[model samples]
Target: MNTIEHRLMELEAKVAFQDETIEILNDEIKVHQQQMAKIKRQTELLAEKLKESQSSQPMMSNMPEPPPPHY
Candidate 1:
């Protein structure tokens, strides 16, 4: 084949490879996005549960101090 034709073929091959790589990267990004969303939801739920648990307990500040052991 002529030099120009060979160069064109090589360029086409490189383009094809780049296209495939981009697609794979896109798919990975989508999966990561989904995972991040799930993690965020779980974190929110955990925070809510923690808040609820804290609210259910009695506050220590409200209780009066007891007499000293020396008394």
Candidate 2:
């Protein structure tokens, strides 16, 4: 085969390999995104539960003052 044809073939092979690598990277990115979304949802749920638990407790600072007795 001629040198030009051989070089072209090698370049084509490299391009194909690069394309496959890009596809694999894309798939990994998608998986990471899904994991991040799941973690975000779990964090939100935990925060909501924490807020509810805190709200259910009574606050001593908000209690009404007792009336003073007459002498």
User: Whose lDDT is greatest here?
Assistant: 1
Q: Candidate 1 — what's its lDDT?
A: 0.97
Q: What is the lDDT of residue 53 in candidate 2?
A: 86
Give a tens-digit lDDT track for model 1, residues 1-71. Answer: 69999999999999999999999999999999999999999999999999998899987679898989999
Error of 2 at 15 (Å): 0.4
Which parts of model 2 are misplaced by more than 4 Å? Answer: 60-71
lDDT at 5 for candidate 1?
100
Candidate 1: segments with Cα more than 4 A from true spot = 64-71
What is the C-alpha local distance difference test score of candidate 2? Answer: 0.95
Q: Could you give candidate 2's per-residue lDDT for residues 1-71 as a string of tens digits?
A: 69999999999999999999999999999999999999999999999999998799887579886778862
